[model samples]
Target: MGRKNISDQRRGEIIISFYEVSRSLGLENASIAKLAQHMGISKGLVLHYFKNREELLLGLNEYILEQHLRVMVSEDIGKMDCKEHVIHFIENLFTRAWNTYFDDGVFYSCYALVYRVPEFKESFKAYLIQLHEVLYKKLEEAVAFDVIVATDLKELTEVIFALIDGAYYYLGMYNEHDLAYKQQIAIYVKYSLRLLDFRS
Candidate 1:
């Protein structure tokens, strides 16, 4: 949104409205008018703060990343042993992504828009880089503590992340029960453990 000195509460409300509207109606169909309608406010109000749909989307994307980071940072991972940290990381990755349709839907929607909207590519890439950094650091810590043997930390992080991403996509596509979706997570976790030379 605009760099105007808006109240944090108000800005948060606007970001959530954008998220809800985009989730309900695909991002392609979400407009300032639609968001205003969803928020029970006037479009002029939204425009006054955001200036444009792109700005609103950018703000919402940042909000999404902030929310994810809060969840990750809130974890007491530092207190856990290397092996427990690895398990928690894997479990948190899958569970967090599967929590809601809006979360993943808006996520991939922003991802899709990155190709056509050049302005968004950097933000999306930065988000991915942050996630990669988190995973890479965790893997390095695991290797340092001899919890796992990974000759190439970067490559191992990519492999583990790719498996989770693939499983997350597949689970989102089906209407199966959450238990079934979690079974998919278990499978990915099993494969990741074996690949990382760690036994669960």
Candidate 2:
């Protein structure tokens, strides 16, 4: 690999190790030393990639953003049409599938730092905007394809995201298999589709 690719790969490795350790141990207790120990690497090597805890936290936010963005585009979206894109999004939005991406505990932990860290706040803001754009673009395509009619695509996107954000935060507090959890997800999905006037 090239020098830059190797550097990027090394950063990724260190960040993933950081994430794993943070999940196993709370983010407050997830230190550079613990991450190095978990990865069986030297503390110096970890510092070589991230100079300090703040820098490491910034990198972790980048990693978190990458994983969260993956939820916007399914592997099958390329094969599906515009309408399928919208359906695929709605179907996956309220699911516990995000667990496969990143642990909610670790995610919220990083989020807490946003109040104190400017870089973390910017990175998080980017995540939110990117997420909105991804779905907004898809909804625009659906409108062009004559799949769904909407008066305001932007408003629709925000409304849907509001439901998702609210439902996600509420649902995270309960067991995924709980009846209230499942029922609330169903109710949100139903209303979200209804807002889009989506018959499917």
Candidate 3:
């Protein structure tokens, strides 16, 4: 039993190492040898947990998707008003999701690969669509409860998502201050609500 547990732990570590490498170097460049060197492990050891590069890339995508789901489906969304919730969500996203996964060059590499690489496009798009759906549902709930006065939930949700995405991208590329990111997102959210004539 102890041996089995150790093996499981090692396997988990290998997966995490692969994810880190992929996030930093892009899936195509995060080769097994490079990952092994980074993790201080042998190529055979990585192969023990994953059959090949494809398997490792797939596992990385799954791990990233799971993390995204956890952030998007946070319970905090259900507990706060639309304005507070949206602001809180955006703030948390920058502090948690952005800071955690994307504090280095690796994330940019992964982003470039995910969008430009035809093979990974489907997984990337699926993850984005899932995120959008979750946000849409949360925004729709806010509308139903009269927290936001938007008649078109879909459009409002897209606007919010786009605003947040744009803010994060800009912050990631040039600025690196949490305060500025939050301020920009807050302003966008307020402007969006006001444009929709949402009175709250």
Candidate 4:
């Protein structure tokens, strides 16, 4: 690869390391020196890429949001009828993606921090709004196709996302092994469908 490409790749690696370290250890405890040591690189190299801790953290937050959106939009949830789409959506959010992306507990930690840290709150809210829009569109298409019963698509989408987030937060807090998480999520999915009066 070109030098620029190599440098970019290294920077990406450093950012990821920073995120992981910060997630495991609180932001206050995760320092540049520790991150560099964890990555087996010098602190100067980390600074060479990020300039400072704030810049590195900003990049990490942006990277996490982008990764989350990528996962949310990856599947063709709009292709299925409303019921099928809802089922698939729940499966993706509560089963597959949740198990993969959030199993480490870092995402929830960052989410909690966003509430306290003024720096991350705006960006986090923006990401949430974008995700809500995508989900609302999918639900609207489902309602139009008669896959689900008539309901407010935007409201329902927000409720579903909130429920998913709540479930994941609890799972991360109490059930890290994910043993009973699937069953709990299934219950919530069924309850949500009933609220929408979905026949299927």
List model 3 lDDT by residue over 18-104, tens digit each: 877766776557799999999998999889888887666666666676677787777765543666775565556544354554333
**Model 3: residue 137 alpha-carbon error in angstroms:** 1.4
TM-score per model over all chains: 0.80, 0.92, 0.73, 0.77
Q: Report the C-alpha lDDT of model 4 over 58-137, residue by residue, as the tens digit.
A: 77777777777766766665464646666776566665464445324556556676767787787778878988887777
Candidate 4 matches the true fold with a TM-score of 0.77
Clashing pairs in 4: none
RMSD of each: 3.4, 2.0, 3.9, 3.4
lDDT (10s digit) by residue, model 1, range 31-119: 99989999899999888778899988888878777776655554555632467777777766666544543477788888898888887
Residue runs of model 2 more than 4 Å from their true location after superposition: 77-85
What TM-score does candidate 3 reach? Answer: 0.73
Ten residues in sequence with the least summed lDDT for candidate 4: 95-104
How well is each residue in 62-117 modelled by candidate 2, as lDDT tens digits?
Answer: 89878877877777555224566666678798898888899999999998988998
lDDT of 3: 0.68
Work out how many backbone clashes candidate 4 has. 0
Better TM-score candidate (1, 3)? 1
> Looking at candidate 3, what is the lDDT of residue 199?
50
Error of 1 at 58 (Å): 1.2
